[model samples]
Target: MAMTNRDRGGKALELLREGLSPYVERELRRFLGPNVEAEAARLIGEDRYNAGKQLSDLDVAALLKVMWESWNDVFRKTLGFAERSLVSELREWRNQWAHRLRCGQNLSLSDSDPQGLLVKPEVARRQREEEQQTVPAPTGVTSSAATGVTSYAGGESSSPTPAGAPSTTAAPLKRFHGSVALSPLRLGAEAGRIAEEVLAHLSSLPGAQVSVTLEIHVAVPDGVPDQVVRVVMENCRTLKFAVHSFERD
Candidate 1:
């Protein structure tokens, strides 16, 4: 008998868990070494004496989220082409089917694909790039150094969109500003996680423009950790957004 979508989803989840667990552990060790174990223990608690033992106890979903939030650096730097897609598709699968043990979508929708993984990230990136290239921004937006909001109601741009391409317009670009407070005790990478979450929330709001530019403001104190800065910048860039890190006394 042919496998149902649910059955396939279940199997996919199994593979995802099996495949990602070791990858996560190996990368964690490679990047941060013993730091990874302590971090993992902190997230889910140190009920188990050994970090590996504790990690094994975490289910796939929790593990995925924790890894993304805490190991943003490793994901960006170390993960290879195929491994990256696997993580991306795993993320999508998790979100679409959060409640059920198995998301109802077939993990391998294509026959050529291996083990229901290996999604092409380029297709999505190219589509977004094209959309961004075509969105027409209103002219004359000046930033008030005080408020940081870009005003776009001034004179129009002298140059026009290159002819022969479809044109699109929106009211104007509003300079979006957001900040998140970081706890020194927690994984500084959480700043990046929070920024990504904020970006997701803003994009989802009603009346939000289809194409948007966001400037994430992160306030850092003296002696800020490198991980915090790296993760926040990397995450914002991944979303095609900008980040401003402001240091204050």
Candidate 2:
């Protein structure tokens, strides 16, 4: 049997937790010293900790919150602002997946679009054919042969075209790529809205390859040195961030 979206999302969350465990553990240990486990239990849930759950066994949300809440003291040295995008996106995905499982339905387009809205080529072709089957012109319409303009009973008129003008068709776009700078993204509705906008543009153009690079503006602290800036950018690349840059005042 094929894996459902639910299963795939669960696996993705699992992989994310596994990948971040080492880093989360390292930071927590550094910050919390010998009290890492105790503090983690308090932050995540005392019950789970009492039930023998360790940091590695905690959920992705818990791990992410630890890093996010402790960013100033720990994660900020090694990670840049763009990494916040990863944290926000993954946290939202996790939340959506959990909510879907509870509601037994996928999130609405306004909430998320991981699978996207694009149809297959055959479906697109069929849709175009259906749309091209013209409807009968509205009744009581008048055509002005002198100006090539048509007027409807509703008083709406089509734009006048010069008679016998050569018809022109626009060439299909071969590729599309663009980038937009964004402020610090928060979890929940705001992140979902941004994801929806990006996917909506992609879905609009069938058969066109698209790439969207979101440049997240980083507001560095008062005293973060140049060396820390280099480390942040390097760490972003090591973690497979596709495009990143850093600037200091």
Candidate 3:
């Protein structure tokens, strides 16, 4: 029998719940302390099908609001969850979302452009070359003995040759590759507004999933940060989008 849209959505929700169970359990345990097991059981006990149905268009908007509020509460009470290091990472994710919101951009994550992040090797090399050219070499001095030190030959003997100054060279600048992921939803059209809002919210976290098989790297200096990622994932999940798994390089 052909499955109804509700049925399909229900199945998907079931899969999501099952797949995220471990992670959810771990996070709940970390945040809820001793009550984590009981709390998680209760949260999961809620009907997946019913929950999926509740997310229908009419109620999604409201549900999203509630979810965001809940996330804020959890985030605040999570204690060490938003440490300085994590906060720093979240800032970068936030910037990515800000760019997508303010501008129009989509990052493609596929085999050819996984995570929509890539480093142009040539650009890095060129930058290294430019840095090397800018550093100046130390000047060297050579001392020669004065042929006529006696004062009789001239009014004043050549000033004593200054001791040869040691020469030094600047260290060569090393090349490091840096790349940024484009937003999955490109900027421009009004259709992207929701994504922009979601991105903005997630960018404040550490990481997120951009697709079913691809997780957005939110680590800083290398990928998106944890807090921002968490926010992004929460937003995606709230929107009923499938979150992808990410493989670190």
Candidate 4:
């Protein structure tokens, strides 16, 4: 008989635990100090600490979450945006396994492409370059400090300075704002595609300090199962969704 999705998921989970355990422990010890378990407990949980005082005792989500939480402090300088994206993708896959374990459903193999999800750093950088090349620059934008006017597409808006008044046309704004609102992502493929587009956009931005925030509002009817909620909320927490609550009349 062929292995069920649940069995495959279990095997994958086992591999992740065994493969990541020693590396996770070593990194934590190096940065977090000799009492790795004690420090990790503060983030993962006290119960987990008491269970075995090691990363191997925890699940894949816990291990990935630890790396995410410590990324800025330790891993940021060492790893780049591609690595960050991989960690985020791994967290999503781990949560998918969590859902499969509970519902025994067939996994969507298309959404979980190994080539895309496990993209090498050099390939990601090259893709970023290609995406940047394809993005069109803003056109017909011109600013004149002399007349205090900004022109776009042959249309001019004037901010005529009073006699002897100083011109501020060249001054940069205090903040720059840009946003893209995606359609409601229901399927794994939809979410993954949108995520890749957003990453490409971010890669094209000018600065390294660009802050990105993801807001997800899960809308489910009253009859939704506890397992579904558990899995959704687990991924939400993994991604650090700001507010989690039921909104209904």
Q: Whose TM-score is greatest here?
A: 1
Best by lDDT: 2
Q: Name the 10 consecutive residues with the lowest summed lDDT in model 2.
A: 116-125
Candidate 1 residue lDDT tens string, 106-142? 2223333334322223433344457658865433454
TM-score of each: 0.43, 0.39, 0.21, 0.39
Candidate 2, residue 48: Cα displacement in angstroms equals 5.9
Q: What local distance difference test score does each model get?
A: 0.56, 0.60, 0.39, 0.60
Clashes (candidate 4): 0
The regions of model 2 sitting more than 4 angstroms off are 45-52, 101-249
Better of 2 and 4 by lDDT: 2
Report each candidate's C-alpha RMSD, comma-separated, in the order given.
14.8, 15.3, 25.5, 20.0
* Displacement of the residue 101 alpha carbon in candidate 3, Å: 30
TM-score: the better of candidates 1 and 4: 1
